[model samples]
Target: MGDLAAVVAARGVPAQEVMDEYARTLDRLVDPVRHPSLCWLRESGRLGTPDEPDHDFRFGLERVLDGVEALARGASA
Candidate 1:
């Protein structure tokens, strides 16, 4: 996730309060009727916060490694 790293590097870490304010703004802006999918995402609480900078990167890397390991196991078998 080079893009994620780049964004984090460029912006640095944002304050939790600032992020919370942005989340609130998003809540207000996303109309349930007009953007049902976005509304669902907003309500789902899956929109991760910026508390941990490397969380998403680490998660993606772990999933990729898991897939590679599975493929290796299949090939050996």
Candidate 2:
């Protein structure tokens, strides 16, 4: 992910935008239903079950977006 971010940065994407997109991509990839191992891990307690797995992922993505938004605002300031 860091390598991908570096490549995007090299291509001239704004740093915050790169991070935001990366986080969004991760949100999509982290869907437990899409990955059987993740489901198994969650069921087996290896990953521990969230009250709402999807919501947890969305919350994390929102936090990441918020951080990126904060950085963008700071840059503009």
Candidate 3:
């Protein structure tokens, strides 16, 4: 993910745009058919259970992107 961020940054993409794409990619990865073991791990709590049921991907990705956005804001400030 870091490598992806670096590449996107090099291309002059806005931070929020990069984060949005990252979030979408993460969402895609959470598909059970595409990543059964990852889905299993999330469901089994190996990836840490989220407060909202069946929202592990959306919740986690939002939290991560939020943090990244905050950091970008702070840096710009």
Candidate 4:
């Protein structure tokens, strides 16, 4: 989930766009394919592929969200 989020986020895509892209990625994964991915792959303007997997991405995402939560709380206080 977060991997997908990171993809759209990295692309300078908005949160809502990221969500829509994520859903489509999931839908694409859900169907019959040679490889089912939890994350969507982007070219990154490079010819190489990413070495990390979806788990690594989501791990960072959880931390990112946690940080956001903390920031929000601090701002509220």
Candidate 5:
């Protein structure tokens, strides 16, 4: 995976631009295979709305912490 800003290893490319590039790459990778079914909730971006109470929170925090722990343990070994 490529990190934002300063390149993976140069020139003066901004971090946000690199991130946007990555997001577009991810979007291309997961292109929709078929159109929405007859019974589907139609919306933009994602299923949950950002304005909703539960929409924004620590959903990915635990997963990220676990990944860091795994990397730490691997380094120790």
Candidate 6:
């Protein structure tokens, strides 16, 4: 999600107009059958709210750490 981080860092929370354009683009391009998970996420009404920019990064970081821990454990075993 480095690209996401870069966008958040550069924009610092998108304006309403930007959010509207993003939504329109998603609506136009995101196909439910082709992009089911992305479509679900788009429909969930949780996109474009980057007020706490680090939230997603931290979440992803923790998951990465968890995977590393599991790998370390397996290596030890």
lDDT of 6 by residue, 1-77 (tens): 45555665578864554566677799999889999999888788777544365776798899999999999999999
Across residues 15-76, which tens digit of lDDT does each residue of candidate 1 receive?
44455666798888888899999878767765635546677778989999999999999999
Total clashing pairs for each candidate: 0, 0, 0, 0, 0, 0
Q: Across residues 1-77, which tens digit of lDDT does each residue of candidate 4 receive? A: 45645676679766556555545565555543543342333222221323334756677799999999999999999
- In model 6, the worst 10-residue window by lDDT is 1-10
TM-score of each: 0.46, 0.34, 0.32, 0.32, 0.33, 0.65
CA deviation > 4 Å runs, candidate 5: 5-9, 31-77
- How far off is residue 45 in model 2, in Å? 21
What would the per-residue lDDT of candidate 2 be over residues 10-54, giving only the tens digit for each residue?
Answer: 888655565566555655667776787765654554333213325
1-77 in candidate 5: lDDT tens per residue?
22332362265665555545655665555535553531133224333222223323345677788899999999999
lDDT (Cα) of model 4: 0.57
Question: In lDDT terms, how accurate is model 3?
Answer: 0.63
What TM-score should be assigned to candidate 5? 0.33
Residue-level lDDT tens digits of model 3 in 23-44? 5565566788978887776556
Q: On a 0 to 1 TM-score scale, where does candidate 1 land against the true structure?
A: 0.46
Quote the lDDT for 3 in model 5. 30
- Candidate 1, residue 9: how far the Cα is off, in Å: 7.6
Best by lDDT: 6
* Model 4 vs. true fold: TM: 0.32
Candidate 5, residue 69: how far the Cα is off, in Å: 10
Model 2: how far residue 30 lies from native, Å: 30
